[model samples]
Target: MRSRSTLLDGRCTISRCLPLSLYRARTTRPLENHHGQTPVRKRLNSDMPASTVSSRHFYQNETLLDFVARSSRPVSLRQLAFFGMKLTNDKIIQSANFVRQELPTRMAHRIHDMQSLPYSIVRNNHISYVYELYYHSFNTIRRFPVIKTVDDNDRFCDVLRELLAHHTAVIPHLVMGVIECSDLIDSKRMDNFMESMLRSRISRRVFTEQHIALTDAFLKDPNFKPTEQVGQVFFQCSAADVVRQCDTLARSLTQSSHEGIPIPELVFEGDVNTKFACVASHLRYMVGEILRNTFEASAERYQAMGNPPAPVLVTIIDAPQHVTFRFSDRAGGIPPEIIPYLWSFVKGPRSMIRHHNFKQVPVLEAIVEELETFVAVARGQRKRISSLTSLTTRSPTLRLGMGLPMCKIYAEFWGGKIAVKSIEGFGCDVFLHISKLGNESRFVQMNNI
Candidate 1:
C-alpha cells in the first residue's frame, strides 16, 4: 500500500481515481463473534464491559481532516495538524465552551439575521466535501502497519491523536450551514436550517458509522498490536437491554437527588427481533440522557406539587435496518415556550461545573503538548461520558443542558434519529431511531465506483 505522503500528494477529491486495492484493504469487515442466538442480545449491566470503540472515540479515525487539508483550498500542514487535534480533543472533552462559541453564540445573531444560499449548490458542495473526507480518512489509515514496540505505539497514538483531532474539529463546520438561518420560526427559514442541520448530521452519521466499523476492523486486525488488548469479539447488542440499564441509572440518580421524590417508574417494552450489530455505549448514553430528563422533570413536577411522580414508558421496535426506542413521559410536555430552543446549543441557567471530582480533565492543552476518550470515564473506570445535557461526565443530574441535542447527534450519527412530540399540559413522546450497523453504510454505490 502506498504511504500517506505518496497518497495525499494530490487533491484527494471524491472523483479521484483511487486504487481498488486500497478500498478492499480498508473496508473489509473484520471477523465477528457471531455467537449464534439468532439476533444475539444482551442486557446492559454494571458488569457490562466498556465498549472498546464508541466509548473512547465519538468521531471515527477516517473522517474529514485529511480531505479538507488536501482540498483545493490552501492550508498549512502545521496549522492543519493543529486544527485536527483540537477538534478531536474538543469533542472528547465535549467542551461546553467550544459548543458555546461555535454553535450558540454564532446562532444567536443568525437566528435573527440569517440568509439563504443557492440551495442545491450549497448542500451538494457540502455533501461533496463530506464524501471527500470519508474517502481519504478511511483509506489513509488502512496503510499503516501494526505497532511492534512501546515507542512505535506511543508515536502511533501521538500521530493518530493529531490526525483524528483535526477530523473531529472539522465536524462543527456543519454549524456553518445551520447558522445561515436568521428566522428560526419562519417556515421557509426553519425548513432550510433544519434541512442543512439534519443533512449535515446525516452526513456525519454516515461517515461516523464508517469510522466506527473501520476502526474496529483495524483494531481487530491480527497485524495490529497495542499497549492493551481491545477485544476483537464484537458482541451482539440490544436496544431493550440498554433501555433497562438507563432506566436503572435514572432510578439511582433520582433517588440520590430528589430524596423524597417518588422514583419515576420506567418500563421497557421488549423487541420481537432483538439483536443488532451496534456500539452499546452510544445507545446507553442516549437512553440514559433521555430517561434522565424524564425522571428529572417528573421528580421536579412532583417536588413542586407535593405529589408523587408518574411513570415513563419505553418501547422498543426492531427492524432489518433499524431499532427504535420510544420514551414516553408524563412530566407535562416541555413548556411550549422552550420548544424553539430544543435543538440549538444554548447556555441554560444551570452550571454544575464541578472540577476534579471526576477524572482529572486535561488542563486545556496546547497542540504541541496535547493528547486523547468517549472517555469523560476517568469520571474513573466506572465513569460515563457526559451526555447531551451534562458537561461533566461525572454529574448524573443532567442540568447543564446539552442533553437532547447531543442525544440526537449520537442517535443520528449512526443513521438513527431522535424525535419528540409533546402534548401541551400533558406529556411527551420521544422516538429514538437507531440505524442498526450493517451493510447500508458508506456510499458504496458512489464512492466505490
Candidate 2:
C-alpha cells in the first residue's frame, strides 16, 4: 500500500509526469489500465486534511451543464436584507444550504467558459492554474453535507473563508494568463470572458459573505437584530464620506510616491452630504482608483513645470434615483494611442510584458491591506505611518494595470458606470454614475455564455 504522502506527491506531480499532449488529452478523456478497465480519477487536495480527502470524490457523477442549470437566480441588496431580517436558526440553515447549492453552479459555469476559450489560451500555465483553483473550489463546496445545526453552519463558514482567501491570487493569475495568451484569443472575446468571470466572482462573494455574516450574528447575540448589517453591504452608506475617505487615501499614496513634488488639492463641490444604501467598500475602491490616477498625473505635470499642482475639481450630483460624481483634472490628458485600450485588461503592451516577466503576481489581499491601512490611519484607528514610504514598498504605480478595469467592474456590479474623456495636452474628465436605488439585481451572468 502507498503512504499518504506518496499519494499526495503523485497527485501533485501527475501533470509533470506525462507529456504535455498526453496530459492535455487525458484531461478530457479517461485512461485504461492493462485490463482495459477505466480507472477512477478522484480530484484530491493534498492541502486538505486526510479526513476531508477521504470523504470527497471527483465530480464524475455531475456534468457542467447540469450545474449551470441548477444555479439560483441573483438577489438584490433589498432582497438580501429582507432575507436577513428576522434571522433564525432555520434561516441560518437555509442560508448554508443555499450557498452550498449556488457556489458550485457559478464555479461550474466559469470553468465551462474557460473550457470554451481557444485551445492555446486555455493551455497556458497561468490560465490552467486558475481553472484548477476554480475546479477545486467547486468540488470543495459541492461535497459538504447538509447543514442541520449551528455547528454545521460554523464549519461551512470556515470553508467559505478558506476558499475566499485561497482565491486572492485569481485576478493576478488571470491577468497574467490573458496577457500571455493575447495572441491566441481576440480582444472582445477575452474581455467578455474576463468580465463574466469577475462578475460571477463578485456575486459568489456576496452570497457567501452574507450567509457567514448571518451565522456570526446569530451566534454572537442572544437576540440578533434583522436591521443590523450582517454582510458587506451597508444600508445607510454615506456617499460623501466615502468620497472623502478615498480622496484622502489616494492623495496620501500620490504624495508618498512623489517626494519634493507639490501635491494637487481636491476641491469638492455639489451634493456634499448625499447618503445612500450600497457597498461602501466598492465605492471606496472605485473612487480611490480614479483619484489616485488624477492626483498622480496632476502632481507629475506640476512638478515638471516647477509650479504648484492644479486642484482637481470633483462635482457630486445627487439625484432621486442615482448619484453621479464628475472628476475634472488639469494635469494632462491621456495620449491618443492609449485611449482605445484604456478599459482593456489584456492589451497594455508594456504592462503586459511586465506582468509576464513577474516571478510572483500580486494578490488582492495585499492591495486591500494597503488601501485599508491608509484609510484606518486617516480615521485615527491606527497609529500614523509614513504613507509614501509604505506605498512605495507595497504597491508601485500601474504595477498590474488592473485599477481602471477593476474599478469599472466594481461600479457596474451594482448597476454603475465609469466614463473617461481625455483632451490632448489638457486634463481629463471622468464621470462615475452609481445607482442609488439599491434594488438593481447583481450583475451576474447565467447561461448567456
Candidate 3:
C-alpha cells in the first residue's frame, strides 16, 4: 500500500517519489456466462480497457454530478424538434441525445460542472484543464473496441454519435472562451484568446475529419450500418438559387429597415453553368449574409447623402478546388480603425441590436418559411434517425454585428475563408470562398476568429 498524498485536485494515494509502477495501469477482468451459481471469469490482456473500456474513466469531480441532478441539465435529444434551438441539424441532435442517454451519471455530472463553469474561469488557463481531461475522454470514446454481440456493437455506434455531438459542442465552448477574453480588463489577455481561437479552429477542423474517417471505418460492418452520413458527400449545388435567395433576403430587409428604399441591384459574373459542387446550406447562409451587409450599408449611406444606392456587384469565380464570391457595396469604406475590430467578437455598448423577439427578424415571414422548407428538403439526404420537434424557426433576421462573424465561421467550417477590403472612402469588397471539396467530417467546424 502506498502512502496517500493531497493536492487541490483532490485525493490520490501515490507519493511523488514513488516508482512509475505505483502509477501503473490495471488489467481487465470480466465475468462471463455466470449462471447465478458459479461465474466464469476471464482476464483480458489489453492496455486500453482500464481507460477506454469503462464509461466512468473521465470523471474526477463529484460536485458536477450534483449540479446536473439539481438542474436536470442533460436535455433530452428528442426535445430539439422545436424550432429556435441553437442548431438546426437533426443528426447532431440525435448524437447529443445518445450521449446524454449513455453518459455515466458521474461523468455527466462532471460535464455539467464544466459546462456551468463561470466565464471567468473558462477564459483563463483553467479551462484548458477541462479540455485536456475531456480530450482524453473523447479519445477513449472514439477508440472504443467493437464487441461481437449486436447489443455491444450498437453501444459502440452510440459512442460515434456522441463524438459527433461533441464536435458540435466545440463552437459553444470557443464562443465562451472568446466572450470571456473580450470581457478582460483593458484587453490584457485578449490577444492570447484570439490566438487560441484560431488554433482551436484549425485543430478542430483536423480532428473532425479524422474522427469521421474513424467512425465510418468502424460502422462498415453489415450489422452496424448507420444511415446518417458518416462523412461528407458532394453534389451539384445551384449558385443561381443561392444568389436569388440572397437578393430577395437583402431587398426585403433593406425595404423594411430603410422605409421602402430601393434595394441595390446585384450583377452576377460567372460561368453560364452556375451549378457548383458544394454544400448548399453553407453557401446559402454565407451569400445571404454577404448580401445583407452590403445592402444595408449601401442603403444607409445613400439615405444619409440623399442619393440612390449604387448597384452592388456580385462576382463568382469558379475555381477547380473552390468557389469565390466577391460582393462590392457602395457604403463608403469602413473606418481604418474599425477594420481591425471587424473580426473580433467584442460587442461594445452599441454593438448588438436589441430585439425582444423573433418578430423583428430582418427578412419577410414568407421568405423565412421558404428557407425553412429548403432546409427540410435538404435534410433528407442524410438518413435522419430521430429528432425532437424543432423550435419554430425565427423569421430570418439580419442580426447586427453577428452577420460577418457568423458568416466567417460558416464559411471557414467547410475549409473556406472570407476577407473584406475597404477602399476607405468608397465601398467595401467582401470576398468569401466555398471549398468544392471539404472533409465531410468537419462540416460543423468553426474558426476561432
lDDT, model 3, position 95: 41
The Cα local distance difference test for each model comes to 0.43, 0.67, 0.46
Q: By TM-score, how accurate is candidate 1? A: 0.48
lDDT of 2 by residue, 246-359 (tens): 777887777666766777777889998887777566677788888888888887788677667678898999886678999998878987887888888878656655585443
Error of 3 at 423 (Å): 2.0
Question: Which ranges in model 3 have alpha carbons more than 4 Å from their true place?
Answer: 1-119, 123-234, 347-398, 438-449
For candidate 1, give the lDDT of residue 435.
74
lDDT of 1 by residue, 51-70 (tens): 21112211322332333233
Sliding window of 10 residues with minimal summed lDDT for model 1: 363-372
Candidate number with the higher lDDT (2 or 3): 2
Model 1, stretches more than 4 Å misplaced?
1-154, 161-235, 270-273, 346-394, 439-449
Find the 10 residues in a row with the least total lDDT in model 2: 50-59
Q: Kindly provide the TM-score of model 2 when superposed on the true structure, using C-alpha atoms.
A: 0.80
RMSD of 2: 8.9
Model 2 stretches with alpha carbons more than 4 Å out: 1-62, 226-228, 353-360, 365-370, 373-393, 438-449
